[model samples]
Target: MSDQPVHIIANFTVQDAAKYREYEKGFFPILKKHGGEFITFDDSSVTFEGTAPPQGRVVIFKFPTEDAATSWYNDPDYQSLSEHRRAGTTLNFLTMVHSLPPRN
Candidate 1:
């Protein structure tokens, strides 16, 4: 397996839990298209370090390739579904590599 890692961090608000479910449903196909993995994650981000009450959900995913992730995001199908994610929540995101220490 490649040592490179694609880490995705998303902090966005969902108008309602039901809406979130809908968004998640629509989100699955796109993610699957890129052969991404649904790693362990949580939504109970009640507070932030030295910040006010958080107002959104937290999501993390590992993509095998940056191109794959980008393609999945820019895909015409996902382009529109992405709007729902934005509409339902305040999106805060960060995408980067792990850059772990060189394996001995």
Candidate 2:
């Protein structure tokens, strides 16, 4: 795996609480399986610069490398679990950001 770290930033609006909870319950194990870590999530975030803050929640998670993040996203088990999320929420964005190179 590459040394570079990657982060997934998911912004979504929950439409069905029960189904979203089911997706949340199943997320961690799949994340761990692919060497990913849950960073944080914000439901009440403010946007200082943007015209409007995100509609709902913003979730952040990290992986040791980009490949690991992609693997987790593409995993069949995770995909199955993601169906719950899809059914329960409207995702505005699920972006992957690469960490900057370490300072020399």
Candidate 3:
């Protein structure tokens, strides 16, 4: 994979608030363990042009490298934690975007 930074865009709608909250509470520590950084999240994000906007929540975060991003996702603890998210939310997508290479 490219060494470029990778950004994650996750969109979901909460179905069970308490279960989703459980996921959120444990997310940060695992993210940081793999060099991830939370950028921002929006409950009401505007989409000027798109096939369609996501459901309820739009989240953005980044990792220093694609490997880091993948590692975070593949981590067993993260996978376990995501069970609560799966039970709590209707996930639209969790997408990865690569940053442009440094200008020569």
Candidate 4:
């Protein structure tokens, strides 16, 4: 694993809670399989200054390394389960960001 962690940020609106729930139930196992860890999730986020703040649910997660994060995203099981999310929600954005290096 690299010293730098990778973070996944997702913003979405659930259209079908039941189907989305199914996706949620299956997400964690695949994430852990590839060294990913859940960070936090917020259904309501207050934006202090941004012109465009994320609407609906915002989720954040981290992985030991970028490779681990990417692998988890592309894993076959995850892809299969993602269908439920796709079918049940409007995904605004899903992005990966690398952690900043430590400052001297």
- C-alpha TM-scores of all predictions: 0.74, 0.94, 0.97, 0.92
User: Residues 1-104, candidate 2, lDDT per residue (tens digit)?
Assistant: 56799999999999999999999999999999999999999998788886864579999999999999999999999999999999999999999999998999
Residue pairs of candidate 3 with colliding backbone atoms? none
**Candidate 1 Cα outliers beyond 4 Å, as residue runs:** 1-3, 46-55, 98-104
Lowest summed lDDT window (length 10), candidate 4:
46-55
- lDDT per residue (tens digit) for residues 1-104 in model 1: 34465766776666766655767888877888887776655667655457744655677787776777777778998887776666667666645555464679
Name the weakest run of 10 consecutive residues (lDDT summed) in model 3.
46-55
28 Cα displacement, candidate 2 (Å) = 0.2
- The sequence of per-residue lDDT tens digits that candidate 3 reaches over residues 6-104 is 999999999999999999999999999999999999998887786766659999999999999999999999999999999999999999999999999
Error of 1 at 10 (Å): 0.6
Candidate 4's residue-wise lDDT over 1-104, tens digit each?
A: 55799899999999999999999999999999999999999999888885765478999999988889989989999999999999999999999998987799
By lDDT, the best candidate is: 3
What is each predicted model's overall lDDT from 0 to 1?
A: 0.69, 0.94, 0.96, 0.92
Candidate 2, poorest ten consecutive residues by summed lDDT: 46-55
RMSD of each: 3.3, 1.4, 0.8, 1.7
TM-score of 3: 0.97
Measured by TM-score, the strongest candidate is 3
In angstroms, the error of model 3 at 54 is 3.4
**Deviating ranges (above 4 Å) for candidate 4:** 1-3
| Backbone collisions counted per model | 2, 0, 0, 0
